[model samples]
Target: MSIQTKTVKAKTVAIVGGGCAGWSLAARVDQLSANTVTLYLKEETNPSHNWGFWQMPWLSDALSKKRAMWNSWQIITDEGIVTHHSRNHAYCSITSDDWFDWCQKRFHSAATTTEIIRLPVTNTDKNMLMTSNHKKRYDLIYDSRPPKADKNILLQHFKGLEIKTSIPVFNSKAAVLMDFRVSQENGIHFMYVLGYDQYTALVESTFFSTSPHREEVYDEAIRDYLSRIYNVTSFEIVKSEKGIIPMGDVRPKDQNPFLYSIGSNAGAIRPSSGYAFSFIQKQITQFLDRQTKPTNPHKKHDLMMDLIFLEVLKSHPEKAQRLFFKLARALNGDSFARFLSGEANIKDYFLVINSMPKWLFINQAVRVIIEKWKRIAKWA
Candidate 1:
């Protein structure tokens, strides 16, 4: 005779926010354990925008839906252009709408006990989440909301226009990672171009500054860059996208055991580069593998390096062009991509450190250390 054992019920999970992190976690959590997921979308749908990242094995499905890709990319400065090519990882772009849809399909196909609710989480008490309709308790809750912005924090802001030119102008094979030929009056300004085809491209005017410029400023810069660099006088704008990313730590203050902050709120956005897509994916993957709340995906050493780089950028905005140019020249395509994607090895880290201005970085590192010590003292 065999004795019958009791079956355990699935844990309930409520995920807040409809963006990349929320959807990503929701899609993959079933792999960790048997769980019922309730996804709370702030809006009925996600806003459409392009997310760019380097290709990786884990992201093969995403690569299938890429809008465009480049095996070779370049960084341009007044000094010259430095081009790098990586056969291992191609730079690819995917639209938010496509990504969200793919995530939804994956989640639904895998988990039958999932619900998608169109409501914003107003407040929380322990494991209980309050929505406009009702309050529900879950074993776990993941909040992917945008972090509150501070005026003093340096921000990476940009406005991109996807345009189609009548003439074959843009180079479709290579992407312009950073063109520092733009006006520097509005902080560390640059032009980023992603060419989809000879006649189509997404041109963005980007700035790393505390104070973002007006919409017209970005538009004017884009216009000037297109006319000057590409010699394009006329082009039809297909779509436009604008975003502002805080180049500062966004770790949550409250330590709720059942509640976790994922995505950018968990510091997925690199303080120096403002790259979040790949980091967010890394955070989710780790969370699934560990079966716990997501933590900052970036390595401590990488974060420290980013902090020092930010300090240098803040202190010497004028030197931004030269600094970035030097960095691009120092690393090949694979190393640069790995470094930016937070997968850098010791050699990659050494290359980055050696590329920077010695004295400036040392001074910044000291400043960062002192500031940390002061904060510790104040807290104590």
Candidate 2:
């Protein structure tokens, strides 16, 4: 009897994008493979961003540090307010700074070949990354760069204002996800926070297709939201953040020979929810597990949520915003709770999509069909 094992030579990975995805992928690749991993970061300072995931069972262990836990959210509607609570799980929020620090520290000690190159990457075949200092080649490349900003593409633009009040007005326990009492116009929605801090609260206003002064709009919305929800007025602003999440519903081509897309660039962001941290982690782990054989690449999930998501953003951005708010307003407390817990199934997702005004969906579908038909007619 004999036992045999084969060793596979590792490939060099050049990650050209230094957000959560770049650092995370670099760390994981360094940990899992005997390969050399280099992170090409856009910012020397860790960017201030927020990453939240549903209360996944594995997240407790996956996250290096725990920042906040929230069990309930206040969903506001034109009709009224409904409180959704889940005893089973609490949504977790982890700061990008913490994750980046953890990744840097882990990669330093992981023994796997890892480097963080502070530079920008150029898009080319020979050296996909072109820095003024040098050009580098990688067997595998992970690009996490944000899509070039375009007003044409419908996007989820948000501004988060982190406020610290002199006296505590926010509950230290419950997390408020959405206070829809404000305006749900032109596909914009408002999400308010009350539970993340002892004396701090985050008020966020989001728009689906357009970019306005998010900070300005958020401050105005918060003034109203807090006054309505907590009946409290003046609060001091400690810090603020604004981010544009490309709801780019378009699927990117496998552009380069060794290039692979990761993070939101790879379409990990849930089109419906605009959340991707947990999904990206799952995607990376599954990808690494399947990479044992060079010829066997990972299969993309067929759900094609991106396709539907893009269409909604392109044709019916307004309706999409309304639908999200409508569903949030209409759902029963228990079902909404389940949805937030990520326990809801595909059917639930579809149900929420279908819950919107049928006429609106129909009109949007008809418009898309007519455009396609016209294009075909012109081609013939």
Candidate 3:
């Protein structure tokens, strides 16, 4: 991080939508500079997820505390359980409410000029943030609102229930990262369990599909999963979170340099994998560190690979599970986690490329190249 010996506060910054990216930006600005930041929270919207990520190198931007963290995680497939424990790279999570509250507390404690209010943004123009009442301008406006999905999109949708069990029944030390024991009815379906303690955990049922499914579908799946996997008959739902994140290659709606797009709107989400917490931290961290701003987190190579992977999902939906299973089997836990977390090295990429069916990727790559050439020729 390039520390400015001469402290200069960036005054008047407006952050739309108090989501992960918005809060991260606001908190960083509050710490680094005296920037009078305005954080706009949409009406009747709570914070987003108990976002978990690797707690090293990128923890600076996560705003995680000792109180809100997990040490390890696991993956369960039809075959068996795959686990990884790294002291250097501990897995951690921060409840959305806790993080949001911390941000509020930070700005308040700092005695800086940070205004946070419930002003739902009606629309966003090129350079202006339109609210229900007033038109506000800032030196720089950071928008974290999600963009519209593509027509032919595969959404990674989920509904999770944070339950407190009546009896102590969880391994607080480890979290189930992915359990492929559930039926892949809509698409590749899995259940993720984040066990906070012996009696508390967030059990989530997630799917990747072309169309959206009802809450009942997820609710039923979660019930069945909890019953069969954990054998938990009694529990109280403390909190629930449901979201539909686009898995198709839909570019961010607003990519204008001056009018910054910071969260999912900024393409922090990977097209193939809908994991955004790590990338979100990376984006905000780079911006704050005076390093090259990560306006585009998805590299061209990653996008291309995702296109081929999504092709398999769209064209041959049945093969999606096998493809992912093979991928996991090929790479160790750390490598797979790193790849999913957007910290994969070239070797990791090569490992992924070599693991998948060569014919599928080669065919897709050739087809994409030909289509591109045809487009260029027509333009010429």
Q: Which candidate comes out best when scored by TM-score?
A: 1
Please provide TM-scores, in order, for all candidate models, with all chains considered together.
0.95, 0.80, 0.86
lDDT of 1: 0.85
Candidate 3, superposed: residue stretches over 4 Å from native? 1-11, 30-35, 61-63, 66-71, 110-112, 124-126, 252-258, 291-294, 370-380
Q: After superposition, how far is residue 185 of candidate 2 from its true place, in Å?
A: 6.1
User: Residue 98 deviation, candidate 1, in Å?
Assistant: 0.9
Write the residue-wise lDDT of candidate 1 on 114-216 in tens digits. Answer: 8988888888878888889899887667788887655688899999999999999998899998999989998999999999999999999999999878899
Q: Model 1 Cα displacement at 9 (Å)?
A: 10
Candidate 3 collision pairs: none
Deviation in Å, model 1, residue 20 alpha carbon? 0.6
Tens digit of per-residue lDDT, candidate 2, span 64-152:
47577677666655656666666655566887778777867877877777787887775546435677788766655667775453456
Best model per lDDT? 1
Among all windows of 10 consecutive residues in model 3, the one with the lowest summed lDDT is: 1-10
Overall lDDT per candidate, in order of appearance: 0.85, 0.62, 0.74
Clashes of 2: 1
RMSD of each: 4.1, 5.4, 4.2
